[model samples]
Target chain A: MIRRLLLFSLLGACSLPAQFGLFLVQNGQDVASSDQTYGFGTKPVGAVVNLEFHLRNSGADAILTDLHLSSTDFQFIPSAPSLPQAVAAGTALDLMVQFRPGKAGAATADLIANGVKLGTFNGIGLASVTVSMGDGSPVPSPLEFGSVKRGESSARTIRISNGENSAVLVNVGTRDKTFQVKPGTSPIPIAAGETATIEIDFVPAADGPQQSALLIDQLVFPLVGTGLEPPFPPPTIDLDRADLASAQQGKLTVRLASPSQATGTGEVDMDIQPSDASANLDSGIQFLSTGTRTATFNVNQGDTVAHFGSDISATFQTGTTAGNIVFTVKLGYFTTTKTLRIAPAVVGLDSSKAQRTSAGLDLLLSAFDNTRSATSMTFTFFDQSGTKLPPGAITVDASAALGQFFTSSDLGGAFSLHAFFPVNGNPGQVDSVEVQIVNSAGTAQTARLPFTTP
Target chain B: MNRAAVFLLCVAPAVAASNFSSPLVGLTGDAQGKLHLVHGVAGSFVVRGAIAGQALDWAFAASGGLLKTADELRVLDAQGNVIGRRTASESQVLLNPRYAFFPETGELWPASAHRDRALLIQSAAVGGRVIALGPADQREIVLAACRGDHLWLLTFDITSGALKHESAPGGTIGEQACQAAHRAALLVLEDRVLLANAHEIVIQTSTGQERRLPIPRNHGTRIHRAGEDTVEIEMSGAPSFVLRFNSEGERLYELPAAEARP
Candidate 1:
């Protein structure tokens, strides 16, 4: 009985319970055994840091279990294996830990296994600031302000937002004198989670594209702007003469004078309009030989005026119809008009009954007075080939000589008058004569007299 | 006297008495008629003789009533500088042979007995023979050439020798028309250049604008600027007629046609 008791005591001593102890192995070394803490260094705010914690069971018989994180900032991804995991003695188990601090401060968490602290994880979050446009859009580098006219200014506002937990001091400026910042002071204070407004102004002194930059402390927001000359005012057009008689020529003028001190450029359009639909006005006017009714003329800087005109020959064909025709001249917003009048009295010559005298030729001319009395008659001679002869070749003898070869009368009715042209040369060689007769109404008529010399 | 001298003496009297009629050869002289031409001994031909000096060797035929010679025409300036030369054909009649105007240069070149090289004014743009040349303005020269159906007017800067403008008046002037243009006379006014032909009168302004004024009754062959605002045009037909016009192309007066004896 004593021998049996001794064997049982030896077995009981050999079969004692295994002690369970946990440690954290980092970089293949026992960090929790040497110290109790693991540092993750400082990181920017809103940044995530990954760390690996190796939990080892240093005891011989017990398994690792009940692994957890004390702080919400420190989390185990995929959760440390189920509680009571069989981690043999002198074996290791891997736990992935993530440190994501929401603010700019130190974050600490305890790594526990089997209700015992394994190690402590410490991380620090940094602070930062960001710049954006006033409209809440991110600031673009080298902002462009397309084209701008001379003496014109443009402005843009920017917001400096402090994204950190602490307030930040911001300074805004530009290297160019053409670019200016509103409030004109540096070190603008912006609270955490708040923004400070800064305005950038680009005033150009000359026309063209310009550039500058906005300095927000160490950060640079490139700025650009263009300067252009102000637009020119429309040109003014005028007619030289306000009234023109039928068969008379007149001139039209286009002047480019702007009261705004701007130089005029581009082309001016001119149009002709007649009061009577039956009266054709364009046919009487000629411009650049490219048709008459409408024309486009150029106006350059320093050049103030251009002139154009047309003869009123077509108005004469309006024949005894007294009316007005208006010429509309337009240059940009400026317009002008001129009036023309056609009268009704007609006076002409009859050349069929031309008689040849011994010394010269006698021409019988008939004058008709429709609205007024016929007053005068004038005569001219041309060869069959339309050449002007010498003055000594012919002599004119009229009853009432108004001038050298004109006869003056006040015949109210249609009357036939005699004008003698004494040819110094042979009358047999006579070709043709032209007669122009005028009435008291300032109306004139012309007729060509073809003669057969006998 | 010798036989030749006696023959010359016998013809001299008749030559001095012969009266030159229409289409007469124009004589060159100063306003005082100091260097006028006297009749030769023979009536069939006339020699260039000064009024109070020895006679010249140049003689022209008197039968055609126009200047005709087998030699070329040489035009000289007042200082006796040669200006132009032209070869005269048998069919060509020299009108106003004593004085001719180089309308291209607006220079009055006088005819001389001397021979010189001719200055031919031309333009490739026209592509045809130059029918007329005149001044478009005081500083510009105009050349009018006629081809098959084209009438081209080319203006050149006189000082720079550069072509400033070119325009082709749309119309087909046939070969007959070209001949008529050759016989036409040119007159340059202050603002217009008048070219009078046998068929029509073409007036071109200093601004390169052209207008063809038709003579419905008769054909014009000569033109002369009578006054600042007047142009005298002469017809080509038997009954001599003269038409006067103002600068604006208005007919002022027309003289009755008369028989011209040649």
Candidate 2:
């Protein structure tokens, strides 16, 4: 009977032994590993997948012990992870259970935290689970950028989807000044269950510059996803600057006057402020009635600190004409106000002075005072039409018969004098006369040869 | 002991005197002009010229009192003199180092580093056959020289690797041979091709042509024309200066020693 009793005690001791178990941990939320139910892809060479697990104190008291298990494909968390406070009852700690994807193909691995046979606790303490890692479908893809023109506006959009349980942020930017993309109000937040579309507009200010980089960022729970986490698209992009000119009425020309670097076909955002307005009133630029005139736009080089102005000219029509526009654009952190003054329209033709035979000829233009402040002036030329030449600014009058010159239309050119209406291509000779100028101040000064043709 | 003798042998007084004062005669316009003057210890100097806006090439080298051709510019000694002067062709003075140009080949028999050496392409000669005389490692010649009476041009062919020579009638070139290292010259024109020696300019054309030239005895050059024969040769001013006939000969103009411009 003693022997039987000892045997029974031994059986009891065997049954009452401490038990242990190990399990899997957290994986990304809603990882739809299309083919694999466990949400794992083909484990490429040298891939590690961290599986998360939760541990609970099911024992009546805080059971402190080391966990031990055997598996080549699995790994345990910090050894003897902080033991939960002496559990008065059935309290628990959601400790992490990690399982890294091993090699490709079907593989199995066991994980151990402390020294313990994790399988031994299957029916007693907890349960043990096996994990497999492999390469799978449903991986995040990249975004592509399209072409844009110089001096013109264009836009593009990248589509990114969140296949995980958590939301993610998408950011966009480039380093080159040749292109500018409209910044969004805030980082685009894409929900795990939804897709976010990013809109990027670019205006290339220079030529041949490219725009690249569209990034997706967010936290990814370990063990929940397949394949690589958050891959980046090719940042290098091809920015085509084929369209430099606007199709509309006016021509806008922007140039980099300093640094002497050659800019290619593209529009770049330079100074923050807009272009100068008064550039249209340039005076020194006078176009020939029969040919194209010279108009220029000026810019000051940042290096020399000297100011340069560009001049442009167009033949006078009923209205204003346009030429290559120079951008006196005030850009960047500093805004400099450029002054553009309308130079007095050129009075001289190809030549300033002309020699004619003494055979009293008809002069074309009536000379007037240059100092005249009023919008309109009535000046008179002597019947003899002879005046001594003087220096200084003078004006031209329309009605006064300074000389007889004619063309079909009003062609803006230096005033000339002639006896007959222009029959052929010639526009007669130049006309000159002495004139008096009257201003609002009642000040009068006379300049000689107010309107003389070159 | 041999090195000392070699040093003295190399140190011998430079014999080739650069005629810098003479102007290139018979050349017209900037394209066919004389090569600029250069003073070097020793090395190959490129002679670039233009005639009617066309370019030409001429290269030369000088060594220990003996001029030679080179593939790459020969290394210079401590005094900046050509270390080794290349000796090529039987008629080195007139062949390798072109004395004059041949109408058939347009090749300068003898070429000059600046004036006398074996340069494939000459800046003052025509453009055609380009040959080079530098290193044996080179497969072809490197320079081409074409000289016309009114045209002087030279070209450098990074390709073909050769130098040729060409010329026209009534044109003046540097017909002198350089015998010393570090010696360089200029091809200038006045009444005709004249060589500047020390302070005096020696006429390369026949003495008869020199007698008729306006270049008077004891007269100095004020200005020079680079191979321009279109307009009459006029040398004006000075008591010793007289209207003399500028003789014509196939003479090469050498740069004079460094001095103030006349």
Candidate 3:
């Protein structure tokens, strides 16, 4: 050992208290990756990554002592070589070191190199290599640890409706010991446009506010392997705009609020409960009449509304979405809330009647509002035999002015020519007139008259 | 208003809207048995048995000869009776008293009494014509007759008021490729003419829209009638010309090849 130490390192000039320690790159390019580097991945448990390293000239000065590299995770592929001699020469001609990775996590090992027996450098040459181990996933959507309202269990299906790419496997986990998970697995592969279900069962410790992690791991997309999931997206929820008001003008006009449905056509579960059920003075709303209700109004294409007005003020019940609805109210003037529904129907055409025109028949029409005020009404003529007549002009009533004539300009394919009437409903009342339908041959027929109040 | 008032005021006296739309399709004819007509649309109505106490009725879906214009057909003083006929022709067919001959599908003189500018329309294409009677010493003469595919109009002499018949140019003579039954005289339905070009069919419609119907290769001219108002056309094989289509093309019908209207 003395002669060998002399020949080992010829330089013994400058030195520290006891030379220094070592950290070896080991004898490896890691080409096959069998030579373990300080990285985390698949690992053979307990099997050391056989590797070694030795020191040449560690520094400018000659080192004083035997050098060796060792660790619990590493050793020579063959075995530990004999202790090396040093200090004769200023430096070593050849040097080598070796090592292997430990468990798949941050591993630590001290590389003992160029240390004397009674030297502090024994532990001083400590170097630790850390590699993190994990099951990778990114941007995975997940649900809470099967925690949902008792009645809303079906809503617990994890929604992956908006996934752009398919995933190989999705990992659902819970870190909480108390919150158990089912279908213990990760990375359930799914094709594009497919959804995967991860069933889990949980029982709260106390039924109160139970909290636990719903971990998502090992998400494999089209070509990507598992990676850490992106930070969870901010929470979201459904929002509704609530606005309530009393029916306008002692009247209740119900109409389809949507293009597809008219008023009174939709389902409405409503009740007029008295704030004070014991208050015997108040009777719940009873219905008097449904009024004139017509149906088959094309929701967007047709108009459907129901109108009602009363002396008492009351609240109406309806669905959350806007559009067609039924109206229910109290029967009499003085009463509690009552419900009435005009089976969804489209009422009077919103358009006003136009001015005068003739169709070879002597007929006239008049319309009015509730106040007995005169309003314009459309008049049509038919030959004596009730056959539709062609176009002719009729004098306009002096009472109504040309308020941008309903302009019966084109009767379309209807034989009767059209003219706009400009009557003000505030003056008098009139509805419509029908020319005689009987032929003018030998017999004479009476003309038909049509009228309305409001 | 109270309940009764509201009820009375809001409700209108309901009047059942009458579904009266169609009109009487019949028209009265004239005092004399001079003229007759069907729909301005050139269709023929048979002199079916009487109904509603009348001898004739204007039937729907009638079949008949082609009229160049709607104004040319009329109902005279008698209701539903055909009256004096008129046709808008590019050339005038002068009627007079003379003897002429038709060579297209040879026939002889015809006889009838018509007071107006009655045309002794010697059958050049489809139907025959009416003639005028002459003087006391002799009986009315019947000289030239109808020759199908072309006409020889014999205009009577104006001065003496006699049969002064003469031959004049009528118009082109051919059938549409699809339904050649209805003859064409240039004036009938020119706008409905669909030209079969080297590769396609093109039609100039009445609404001033031009439409080109796609035709498969190796198709020939075969106009098919599918309904009272619809027509379908197909070509044979590898159309030698461009296909053209037109819906405005006047509709024409005719007897079979054996009965080429004379």
Q: What is the C-alpha lDDT profile of model 3 across A303-401, one tens digit per residue?
A: 222222321121222211112233332211211222332121111111122222231111222111111111223234333355432232122221122
TM-score of 1: 0.32
Task: List model 2 lDDT by residue over A85-181, tens digit each.
Answer: 2322344444443344332234443334333333311111101111111122232232223344443545454455544455544443444333333
Candidate 3 C-alpha error for residue A366, in Å: 4.8
Poorest lDDT segment (10 consecutive residues) of candidate 2 chain A = A121-130
Q: Categorize the docking of model 3.
A: incorrect
lDDT of 1 by residue, A1-454 (tens): 6875555444434432333333455577755545768777766667787877666556554444466889887788767577545555676677778887665557898877656776788887544567788898988767877776655678888877788777655656898878889979876777888878888888877667778788876567888888876654454445545544332333445555653333333333333333334332222332321223355554434445643323211111111222554455555455655454444445432122455567666654433333333344445565667764433122222223322111122111223444455555566555666665565556454545666433
Which ten contiguous residues of candidate 1 chain A have the minimum total lDDT? Answer: A312-321
Tell me, by DockQ, which candidate is best. 1
Best by TM-score: 1
In model 3 chain A, the worst 10-residue window by lDDT is A409-418
| Cα shift from native, residue B257, model 2 (Å) | 29
- Ordered from best to worst lDDT, the candidate numbers read 1, 2, 3
Q: Which stretches of candidate 3 lie over 4 Å from their true place?
A: A1-42, A48-54, A58-71, A87-105, A114-454, B1-262
Residue A256 of model 1 has an lDDT of 51
DockQ order, best first, reads 1, 3, 2
